[model samples]
Target: MAHTSPAAAPGAFVAASDVAALAAGAAVFGTGGGGAVHTSQVVAEQALQEHGPVPLVTVDDLGPDDLVMLMSGIGAPTVGIEMLSSRHQIDLLVREAQIAAGRPITTLMAAEIGGSNGVGPVGWAARLGLKLLDADGMGRAFPSAAMVSMNVAELPCDFAILSDVVGNVSVIKTIDLHWLERHARALTVASGSICLGAHYPMTAETARGAVVEGTVSAAIRVGHALLSAADPVQAVAAELNGAILLTGKITDLDRRTEDGFARGSVTIAGTGADRGRLQRLELQNENLVVLEDGEVLVSVPDNVTIIDAETGQAISTEMLRYGQRVAVLAWACDPIWRTPRGLELAGPAAFGYDLDYVPFKEINR
Candidate 1:
């Protein structure tokens, strides 16, 4: 098992020991999505153990001329859990992306700082001897590729490079994020619902203010808190400054993999002091909303995580099992996600839900 070390200075440096904590913390932000983290943890640990620690640099640390790429896996969490990805797959994708980038890729960043995507890039950076950016496109995971900070910031995606485990690769050039989502999903579905890719190539100058900053370090902090605390569940919530929305056992789950996403709803019957109450979670890959009696209690653009009540580990949508006791936690997302354009790109409306995003602070306070 990988062990975590003390927090690093300036910015976090992810070593082999940090993989376990990173995966655990990343899962919390995953919000029951972002593809499961177990396999990602293993791969990351292996890479770090072999290649030494990767320096996690902040956006400000980057030179204006430096090139950065977003490294991530695209597919349903259900499929990802079954089909383990190899370093060779990531190598192919990054190599192809580099060729398309037309310049040396100085840094690699997570497209989303949730689940496996958050952890995968650490290994990719280590293996490639590149720096890992401490920022990400999404502070939490979203099902669609278009729901990224760059899109909300109106930054253009020059191209996206994708590759499957079997060596098939494709480079898509499109300024439209939605079109990228559509085409990438098609290729991912064709490649057995899982593939590795790099996209959103931009100069450090362009990325400095366009991405969700410090998410990688935040994940490490949450993971470290979870590992050290006696009451991990409460500790994690406290660390994130989040609230426990519900504590219950999964009574029913309706889930399916379609169009490269795990779409579903889960019903939980509240236990303990909250007994006799029922809540439903509607999800498209990531937990989208929490509802009770048809009333929206919590919705997207805010972080909603369903975690194992006893262990504090987030239970991704694909891993939800009937009768498992869990706790639902809610926290405010980055302030950027609350802005008009951010909401337009990732709000309840973006996910096809008709509801206003209530700020977590307002709701909690």
Candidate 2:
């Protein structure tokens, strides 16, 4: 296991091999929705070559007064394949955020954990020399930015700066976090359904309180595990202390692309220890729920990941299909999300389900 020393400065060189490991880590943290890692790694590699190495910074290393901003690509990942982004688009978003906040963004953070989203921030961080926080808004990837723990913590979601590759830039100020999601999603759809934006301005105090710490390091660990382990599923399970929810061949998948979202469910016929059993997964861009024998085993906030059982690589919801053999992994959410208010904000009930939030530990036990 590779570990950075505590005495190391916030901004230190990250080698190319480590970047590959970090990308794998991002995939596990992505919880099956941070877009693809290949794209992010390419961008990060380009930035590294042009601007030299990028640094990883912990939230504690930031000054209380420093303006830290979060940046991410928001849209349908399927659409992103066709609409590639330019570096200028990212710069536009960051610059606009600085202008809106009236202070230069001294640091950067990923809005979510996923292969691409996690690695994407590295490009911006390398280009701008902004310290990349070893933390993120969502420990696992979710479809909407507002689904982050930061939003659940009542952090301000307004004042997002958005930009398209075509040079269109706008600052969105909304009355509420939901409104921010609604407005941003609409704007993103109109702007070719793939826009880069920066939001969630926070002092170091707020960051310490809400952000999932050590996520960048987690992503790196996950990536390394995936690359080094003979069985990647076991590697991920060890890294997350997660349970292998189910392993079987996908027998059916009900899917529909609607309202700019991919909504669906997958049914898998059990094998091995799970033989004679059935597993099902519900998804909305991100995997939201998992069921075994008709009982809810995992719900939102807690991660539900589907991976190719044979390869041990994650399978995105959009790529889910019948006849694919998959292994389901369930990991616990951040401790804060187990609270009443956190449940009310993002639990299964909030997603229109009748069941209450059940921590993965309890279910696994």
Candidate 3:
């Protein structure tokens, strides 16, 4: 299904009324990647509450001369709960990126429209007095920075400005987006495993051609639909053109924090419609693969999200426990992700699955 209806629009931008719902919905879309939303939600809510509504600018609103960039939090979700970013720190990072460009940075955009990183830009835009774009880089979360649609369009990161809460900062100028991610990952690990940064500076004209449009509104719409419905998870999945893949209790969780990532697998003892079966999931900061009876079911580029069966809340990888009742859902990724270049950056092979990715539509066929 289409992510949103244009007639039920929130104008040219995501209004303040959409922030909370956006966070809730983004968690489901996150598919267990990006940082957890609880802390980021509290922070974003507070910013919106104080700032009224951040201005949301669409690609059409931009002048060809306008400058835009991506702002997102990068780190392991497990560590971020204990270490939250000060709003001023996020503000500082954006300012530096703006200054580095030696021109006004017209709008700030999300690198991915999922989890905490999705809504984090809304507040940052208002605090910095810049317009927040309704467009985004990735339609959902991915583990690597180079996995964004902007890269698929061949737009370089240009310059990056990253900062930690503890007062450390780095400015990066890279020749390739791949090296940009590698250096940023190393910096993220060095910055206490979590930090906020901005990159992929582009002209408004480039943003129109490269970025995924209306994704912020799409996130809010999905969130609102989930909240108003009785079966939020199911509604969210169906609304997003996804499916409920399994109903089960997490029976075995083997996870470990490695190289600034929460990497591992979760085993679920199927229940309800799937009683007596077992499902397994591979993780790398986010849910990357799915299997049932040891047969590969879903992989990266096809989002696999684990939600609380009872509450319809998306469960972050760090929050998985050995006995939590959950529902695992799978949705087709954005079309950009299905292209050869897109797959090379985020397909099952990219995550070391040793298998080719089969598109959701193909599977349904």
Candidate 4:
């Protein structure tokens, strides 16, 4: 993930047209995870068009006494795309979470910065007249709910509200975030593979300390750079201080359902100076590992993203197709991700790989 100084207290607005740009930037931060936003973008654009602009507020805008809830989608992006949830689902989760707390919510924030979850709540903010905090729990998308930095900060995620497309709503009060993830995944599969949720209501003070600051604006600006720059791929690398890790065309893609999640791998036959060599990428809902000739190039925590070499569009793990040309990229995560606890919570080992976390700089060098 990329970082900049904290963004100023919010009061900005996202025009309906520019929401797509935010979605683009969010995909970059997704690091080949967070599910894709193709459907979410179309749906969000329509909502924004009907409702006008959505207001944005930074964590700094909130007082210590404010109440905030985390908003996100639970399920495979592919499934969520096919099984569209109701727009009213977000509002329902928010209301239910608040109802469980017996307090009204002052603002809504994303639990993770991602393709859909990062900017998804703007739709709700517009219709509900609630403040939308700009930061998120995970700077980039992580596979599990407990991977959020808020959990690292020891914030309790209780009274989660989940709803399916067919109007099945479940209000779960869990003392453990892992339980929240497990039960939520089960519910999501039962709901035909996508559920909208709101959880981890926290004080503004806790949110201020826990979230990855300036991520929303960062996504917006990255989106703008991609639109304006001649080489969108290079533009992203430059803007985020990332490295072009590899360039190639996908030769084969292997995907399957594992433990109720999408897990797979892909092989990219290198092109240009890298011709005759092959690169392999492992997946678990997100890009997990990058290997060239059996040597690790990049791994989880630090981003490992695949972008269309020509159009610069991101290809999510579930969307990788054979014969599509692409470029691989990597960059350092926020400083927090390098911490011992952060690694323990979200590092390579956290993803079930028998590898220690390597900083982007070291791995790339």
Residue 109 lDDT in model 3? 89
Candidate 1 or 3, higher TM-score?
1
Error of 4 at 292 (Å): 1.3
Give a tens-digit lDDT track for model 4, residues 11-109: 687767878788888888887777787776777777778778776777667786679888888878666556777767777777778788788988878
Candidate 3 residues lying further than 4 Å off, grouped into runs, are 1-10
Best by lDDT: 1
Model 3: which ten-residue window has the lowest total lDDT?
1-10
Candidate 2 CA-lDDT value: 0.78
* Model 3 lDDT, full chain set: 0.82
* TM-score per model over all chains: 0.96, 0.93, 0.95, 0.95
lDDT against the true structure, each candidate: 0.88, 0.78, 0.82, 0.79
Give each model's clash number: 0, 4, 0, 1
* TM-score of model 4 (CA atoms): 0.95
lDDT (0-100) at residue 248 of candidate 1? Answer: 94
Q: Which ranges in model 4 have alpha carbons more than 4 Å from their true place?
A: 1-5, 8-10
Candidate structures ordered by TM-score, highest first? 1, 3, 4, 2
lDDT (10s digit) by residue, model 2, range 184-233: 88888888888888998888777766777777777777777877788988
